[model samples]
Structure formats: structure tokens, C-alpha cells
Target chain A: MYRSKPWRIFQLSGFGSPEEEGERIRFLLEHGETGFIMEHDRNTGDHLYNVDHPEVMARREDVGLTGATIQSVRDYETVLKGIPIESTYGHPGGGVVQHGPYALACYWTVARRRGIDLGKLPGTGQSDFFLTYLGCVTKQQVPTQTGLRFNADIIEFCAEHMPHWVPVSIAGYNGADTGLNAYQELGAVFANAVEYLDEIQRRGNISIVDAAKGVGGVSFRVGMDLFEDVAKLRAGRKMWAELLAKRYNINDDKAQRLRIHSLTAGSMMMYPQPLNNLVRGTIMALAGVLGGTQSLGVSGYDEALSIPSEHAHQMSLRIQQILQNETNLCAVADPMGGSYFIETLTAQVEEKAWEFFDEIEAHGGFLNTLDSGWLHQVAHKNQFEEQASIDDGSKIIVGLNAFADDVTPFDIDGFKSSSSEWKHALERLNRVKSERSAKLAAEKMRDLEAACRTDTNIMPAMMEAMDAEVTMGEIGDVFRNVFGDWQTPISV
Target chain B: MSALGKKILLAKTGLDGHWRGVSLVEKRLQEAGFLVVMIGMATPDEIVSAAVEQDVDLVGLNVGGHIEVVHKTVDQLNERMVGVPVFAGGAIAPWAKKELEDRHIEVYPPGSSLEDIVDAAFRLCRINVKASTLKIEAQINPKYSADGAKP
Candidate 1:
């Protein structure tokens, strides 16, 4: 199985203007990265606000720091310039629920314009509930029920239209980084997958087997506890297979195997001794490999300080390359198999994971937990306890709670994206507002609003809106009017 | 003086919502007998107005964006409430930390222990640590005797 293919080197990268984000993608692709991820500015993209919106205007300086500002199809075109979308494996950033349809529609629209078949496109878009509702809860989001509908629509849309596209990826990495322990992460990830699968099953638009295949491509986070993480991944695959077989009665081999994309824990990166994180990255990457991940993204060494600089991004790629080339670790499948310690640990993790999964089920599934803040409370408790461990010296995070001393050496100031990104994005937003056929944009927005109010899938109208060059904020207005805002359970 | 009346205001200074640090800091301060009020995500003007209205002894910012924004908030606080101390913690780079320190703002970047954060809070709010510890013990075990006697 390991020899079937080498794990893809996928890095989360984007910042500044469209041209700048495109340049960074090209750089990563040139530096042995197998795939590129497009990260849109969270301030606008997560909230679906245009740069001209009042909220964005208040904190204008933070506009381009997180990712690029892609307000419309025009911005998407500029970012995808000369990138050969048909041949590349990309993650067009829609890590939030409400932005998923727009992000995917823009990319698919760009591909259709380029004469690429929709069925042949290879990419993934994450409308992760973990990221949206639990980990990095945005300022405004559609209710959990609405978010569920959006995800279900994407699953069915991909099942029919784009066979190669991963409609939505449920990333446990975000949840784990937030505070979920290993077992809780595993349990929550499966509980989340069950929500999608059950929703797709309820709709009866697509076969449950196909929907399971779509949800099988998930990601997890690996931290400093190398052995536990390796065991967690192993148990995760087993649980996925067992859950599908026992719950959904899917005996298909293709549907049974889970494809994992592992990212090293970003929270583990130290702020004081940033260089020490390189070793941490290497070790976490090794755990992913041992756990048999299908793809991997190493968190930059300077993750705690800021987004990855070009050197740090390059260093991330090098760590993956060194493992793939120099280590010869890919020669054997299940390298940790048959070891008594690993076997026992994997079983124990799986057992504990099932208990947590059952606990969530008893409390009313995953979405209800998020809506009721039960999951957040659990994570909150763990967060406090984790800090307690560090405070009591039970946990020694070398440079953080233990070492307590560091020499003044090299300084890593972190990456600074273009300061004028917000201004440029605002200018583009205005140009689209004026340049686009207003009549058609309004009609498309009405259709999207109508779709949001009905049981019909919103992607078709959303795609039409993107074609009409509808602004992100306009779409957000429709959502706000139709679905209103999600009452966040926990106050930030 | 007792720590009961000390009020601490915590607010996130950016649009980004990563509340792991903020939540922990709030809980720690509460355990140490400080009343903590969280104004989820606030602008400089909002933070300043809230600080004034709440009459907080100290203002803690969970910085997740540009240092310029934090500076703006500090400037507003300094202008509005002359002596209310302010501190911050988040994804602060060394340079940003230095910049904040230059303005006499204590920064607790990532890797900072909770003990240090609580210590900073007591120091910033000018509450005696010994008094706060005694108050916490009294609250936790109400019937306990002070001179090593069992309840």
C-alpha cells in the first residue's frame, strides 16, 4: 500500500494580492510541492464580506494577512493565471461553510472557461464544521442546520457533476489544534462524517456508498506525542471502515479505505525558540508517514509567530522531500505493524475513540453538540487541563514551560504580505460592482436567495451568480436575510 | 486590599476568532479572584469605550492581527483611561513584542505559561498575590482554618 504512491506534498499557502498568491503557488509547485492550496482572506472569505463592508473596513489592515482577497471571479482568474488548473491538484480555499459554494463555483467556472471538463477536475474544497463552528468560529455564519444543508448539497453536486473533486473535507486538524485530545479528535471526526453521510443518505439524491467515498478523504493533526498520534491514525482508519460497514452496510473495498491528509499541529510551534519547531515538524511528519497518510502538510517552523515566510515554506517542503527521498521509509507498508506496543496502543485508542463517539451520539450527534456548545465545553476543559499540566511541570514544552532560557540568535520576523492588499481588493470590488451587468447579477442573487429559502441545492444558482460576477458581500447579504446569523454558543 | 473588586476586561483586537488563549486567561484570572469580562471581538473604539464604562482595573487584548491595530487600541486606551494598565498575548512575533514593550505594554506571546499570565494580571492590576491566594482558599474551602487546622 505504501508503494502504491508517495504521499503528496501539499502546503497551505496564500497571502497578499492575487498575483502575489499566484506567485507563491508557483514557487511551491517549483519547489517539489505536489499540490497547492489557495487560502482566501478569512476576514472577507470566512464572513463572505466584501472588502468594502463595514466590518472589513474597521480592521482593514488585517485584510490580506491571512490569505489573498478573492472577492469575485475576476480575482480568482488573476490568482489562477498561468497555473494550469486542469493539471494541478488544488485546494481553492473555502474552509468555511457559507463560502464553500462560491469558492468551488469560482474555481469550476475558471476551469470551464479554460475548456476543462468538470468531471476531470482534481481538487478539494473544505466547508469544515470543525473550522467554522468549533475551532475558528467566524464572526457571522449560517445556523448549523443551514451549514448542514450546504454540505449535503455539495456532496450530492460532486457525486453527479465532478467525479474527481472532493466536495468537502472534514478536517480534524482544526479541532485538535483548538483543544480536542487524540481520542476526542478521532471520535469527533467520525461523528462529523456520520452527519454528512446520514444527510446524504436522507436526501436520496445519490447513493450512500458514493457519499461515503467523498467523506473518506479526511485530515488529522499530529502533535509532539509521536507514538500516540501514529496510533491514532491507525485506529482512525479502522474505525472508519468499521463504522461504514456496521452503520451503512457498505462492504465495498474502495469505500472502506480512508485517505488521510496529515498536518503537524500548528499550536505546537514555539514562539520563543522558533528554530526548535523544525525538529518538531520533522518528528510530526515522521509520525504521519508511519501512520500511512495519503498526503501531508508540515506546519511552518514559524507557525506560532506568523504565517510562513518563503524560507520557512521552503523548509517545510524540504522536510517532506528529505523523508521521501533520503529516509527510504516508503519501502514498506504498515512498518509499525505486528509490534506489540503499537498494536496494543492502537486498540486502546480505538476503544477510547468509540466511547467518545458514543458519548457524542448520546448527546445528540455532532451538529447539535456544536449548537449547544457541548463540544466547545469539552475542548475548553481540555484546554484548561493542558495548561494546568504545563503549569505544574507535568508537561515540558522545551522552550516554553521547561527550558526557560534562550540565547539571542537569529531573528525571524515572520512574513509580511503586501500592505496595500486591502486597497487593491477594494478597488477591484468597486470595478466589479460597476463593470458587471447589474441586471444579471441581481437576477442571479434573487435566484440564490430563492434557492437558500427552499430545499433545492444552491450550487446551480451560486454558479450562475459567479458567472454574473456577483460580489461576495452581495451573496452574504442574501444569506443574512434568508438564514440570519448563527448564534454562537461560546462567547469568544 | 482584597482582590474581589478587581475587574479585568479581555477583548480580541482582530476579526480573526481564535479563543483558546483568551478562554484560558479568563478562567485563570477568575480563579485568582479577579472579575473577568469578555468583550468577544472589539475595535479600538469599542474597547476604549468598554474599558471606560466597565471601569476595569486592567485591559487584556488577545492580539491576532497587525501590531498597528494593537497600537491603535493602546493609543485609544491611553488617551481615554489614563492609568488603566493593558497587556496582550497571541501570535506576536519578537519584533511585535518589542514594539509593544516599547510602549510599556506587557506581551505574553505563545509559549507563555498561565502562571506568568496570572502573575502579570495581579501585577498590572496592583492586587497583592498573597491576598488573592488566601481569598481563593477561603472560597474553595469555606470552613478551613488559617493556621494549618483541618476543616
Candidate 2:
């Protein structure tokens, strides 16, 4: 079954200046990567701030460490300069919910400027709550209700205009990596899907089937628990199909089919004897392929230290290539489907997941759980247990807890972020601020803010704001003032 | 007051908020009877002010970004409060760890155990590590380490 449909070899690639990010992306594409993911700087992109924002300025040296510093449409242009956006399955990074609109608008604006039709563009905007609210909680973000509204609006906007785009892909990967168990990840993901579907149904403008199709392209984290994770993917697909058919009572084949993207779990990568992570990544990637993922991203071996170095990134791509070309693992879809052990595990996971789903519903659904710190509690409990096992020697991670010594000749001192990134990004921010039509930008920003204040969908105004050259920090200002910030339930 | 009940101030220097690492450490410290005042993702000024205001026994910095930011925060804290001991843990690289260690700050990068961190806290708080270990042993079983004997 898998032989017919090849998995897309996607890699999360970006760092330093926009030009450098472009060069790196170009290198990945040239080296057999089927698609590319643009990783924006977590300090800026995740927080929706510009380089000059006080919070960013306070830590200016970290500007381009996590990812590239893309503050405007012009920066997006610089990042996507040589890449063929029309063909490549680009993931213009907006993993955070509040930053989703800005990231998508900037990418779409760049495509439009290149005379590419928005309808034909194929890409994904993450806008994941797990990333924004739970896994990597930003210093500030719009409250859950506002985040729900923004995501619903994005789904609606995508349904009307950008039919090809996967808007708001709910990533269970972030939640799992943060500490959610397998069944909890499944339960929380479906709980999130139900929230989105229920809201769409209430709106009545977009059909539930279309909304389901848009949200069905979810991602999961495949980790060292090879069999269980593989079973999770299978169970997830079956659960998604049953969910649509049972809850919504609608079952178009396209709507029922769950498109999965799997990333190797970064948290599982060990800091010591970093080369061991290559084996870990390969095994995790194999799990994803065997589980019949539509796309896969193998985590870099140096993941524990920092973002992928060039060699680490290349090694990740090569692992996927070897599996795709040499192993013949993709020759059969759901190869372990009929195995007695696999089938039993899959059924067990599905049952446990539904029980978890009921627990979420009993506690007032996904957003409520996040708001009340219920979800964080669950993740934290599991994290503690896992850590305890490792601490007590019940769980032995080679080269870390068990085989604790290594004398390798490989000089692996993880990638360091460029010091000049802040200086350059600040210059670019100033240039954009000075070069743009100040009056038009101000007017458009006001329009965006007004849209945020009202019940109107915020996408069109956001697009206009991007076109008007409004910087990311300005958009964040509007969000902070209009929507207020989320009271983070857990004390991080 | 209990030997392990020394107050500690913990803060993250960067905006990236993957809290699993720090949260785990905080939980371990708290379980070991440390009064952890967690200030999540604070600026250098906020960290220094909190360190002074809280009047904690030790300061724990969770470093998640460039070493410069963490270094600056540590330098400011040292300048303002001369004798306060500081230890850090997170995704700190080898070079960065060396730099931090050079400045007399205890560096615990990823994979450092909770036991080690707790031991460091005991040491920084001026509590006898040997006494703390004996106390833990006594708590686990009174017959063990009652006379402060090594297990």
C-alpha cells in the first residue's frame, strides 16, 4: 500500500540571516530533500516580535539561534529568493498560534508578488496550540478564546481562497515531545480537532467536511518507543476516520483520510555521545515509514545541543534517503497491520485514547484543559515518571545513563548561532520601517487591529497589513492591546 | 529550618519556553526541600532584582539561548549581589559551558542528573553534602546512615 504513495522527505531547515537561510534551504533541496520547512527564530517568530522589540533587544545575541530572523514580507522574500515556492511543499514557519497570521500572510504576499496564484500554492501553516500554549509557551500570547477565533478564521479563509493550503495543522508532536504519552497525544489531538470542527459547524459558513479536510493533515512525534508509536499512527488514522463518521455523520473519503507528518522526537536525542542519536533518528524514521506517514522529518543527531549543524542536517536527509531507496521498507503500506501483537497494541491504544478523549470532554474539552493546567499536569506527571525511570536505572539510555563514557574522535561541539545576526536583523528592520509607506502601513495596521477587536475574520486585514509592510512587532502590539495575553496556567 | 529548606531563585534567560528541562529540575529541587522561586523567562534586570528581593540562598539560571545573554545576566547578578552563588542548566553547549564555568558559575548541561543538581544546590546553600546525603539516607530508613556512615 505504501509503495504507491511515496512519503515526502521534509526537513526543518533555517538559521542565521534570510540569505543564509535561503542558501541552506537550497542546499537541502539540491541534496534530495523533497520539501523544506522554514524555521523562523523562536524569539521573534514564535513571539511575533521584531528585532527591536524590548524582549528581543534584551537578548539580542539570540536573534538567529533557533531559526532565521524574518521580521517582514521583505525578509520572507529574502528567505525564499532562490527557492521555487510554486512547486516545493514549503512550510513557512508559524508554529505558534498568534504568529500564524503574520507568517502565512507574509508567505502568501511573497507568492502573489511573484505573480503566483494563491489558489495553487501548496504549503502548511502550523498555528499549533501545542506549540503556542503548551509545549513552547511564549512570554505572551493571545488568550485561548482569541487563539480559537484566529484559527477558525484561518480555516474559513483557507476554505474560501487557498484551497490547496493545509491551514492550521495541529501538531501533536510538540505535545508529545513536551511529555505527553502516546494515548494522551492521540486524545488531546482529537479533542483539539473536535473543538475546531464544532466551532466551524457553529459558524455555518464553511461545511464541516471542508474544515475536517483542512485540519486532518496533523503531525505526530515518533520516538524510541518504536512499536507503540507505529501503532499510534495506525490507531490515529482509524480514530480520525471513525471520529468524522460518528460525530459529524459525514464521510467523504477525502475528509476521512488522515494525512500524517511525523518528526523524530528531539527530546529523545542524547547530549553525550551525540552520534548515537543517528541510530535513534533512523529507528524513529523507520517507525514513521512503517506506520505509513505521508511525510517525515528526522531529527538531527545534534538536536540535544542546538539546532542542526550543516553536517547534522545533511545526515538527517541521508538517513531518510537510505530508507527510501535502499531498505525497501516503504514497499508495503501498514506492513505490520495483521501482526497479532501490532493489532492488539493498536486496538489498546485506540481504546485508551477514546477514554482520554472522554476525560477531556468531562473536563470541559481541550481549551479548558489547557486553560486550567490540566493538560500540563498530565504531561508533567509523565515527564517526571520517565525521568525517574532514567534516574533509577529502570530506563537505560546508552551513552547517557548506562554506557556513560566515550572517547570518540568526532569533534561534535554543536552549532553556534552567528553573533552578527542581531546587528544585521536590526538594520533590516530599520530599513523596512524607513522604506515603507508609513501612512499606509499605519492605516493598514489600524485596520488589522479593528478586525481583531471585532468578530470579523482577521485574515484579509492581516494580508493587507503584510502588503503595507507592517513589521511583526507592530502586529504583536495590536494583538497584545486588543486581545490581551494568555495567563499561562503552569509556572514554567 | 531544615538543611534542605534554603530558598533558591530560578529564572530562564531566554524567551524560548520549553519548560520540561527546568520544570523537572525545579520539581526535583522542591522535592529535596528547596524553596524554589521560579521566575519564568525574565529579563536580566528582572532576574537581578528578583535575586536581591527574594534574598534566596542560591540562584539557578535556565539558559536556552546565546551564552552572551546568560553571561550578561550572571555578570549583573554578581556585580549587584557579590557573594550569591549561581548554577545553570539547559541546552548549553561545550564552549558556552566552559565560559560559564570560567566565571565561577556551576554549569549543568543537558543529561546532568537531578541528583547532581540537588547536590550542587546543597553545596551552594552552604549545607554539608555529606550531612545532606546522610539525612536522605536516614529519611529512607532510620537504621541506615544514623551515625553519618557512608552507605
Estimated TM-score per prediction?
Answer: 0.96, 0.96
Cα lDDT of model 2 by residue, A1-492, tens digit = 557767999999899999989999999999999889999888888888889888889998888988899999999999999888998899998889998999999999999999999999999989999988889988889999999999999999999999889998999999998889999999999999999999989988899999998889999999999999999999999999999999999789999999999999999999999999999999999999989999999999999888899999999999999998898887777899899999999999999999999998988899988887778777777887787778668999999888878989867888887977999999999999999999999999999989988889999999999999999999999999998989887664
Q: Which 10 consecutive positions of candidate 1 chain A have the poorest summed lDDT?
A: A410-419
Task: Give stretches of model 1 more than 4 Å off.
Answer: B1-3, B130-151
The local distance difference test score of each candidate is: 0.88, 0.89
**Could you tell me which residue pairs clash in candidate 2?**
A1-A333, A2-A333
Share of reference contacts found in each model: 0.56, 0.58
Give per-residue CA lDDT, model 1, range B57-135, as digits (tens): 9999998888888888888888889988999999987778888999899999887877788888878877667422432
Q: What's the true lDDT of residue A397 in model 2?
A: 93
Evaluated with DockQ, which candidate comes out highest?
A: 1
* Residue B133 lDDT in candidate 2: 55
Worst 10 residues of 2 chain A by lDDT: A372-381
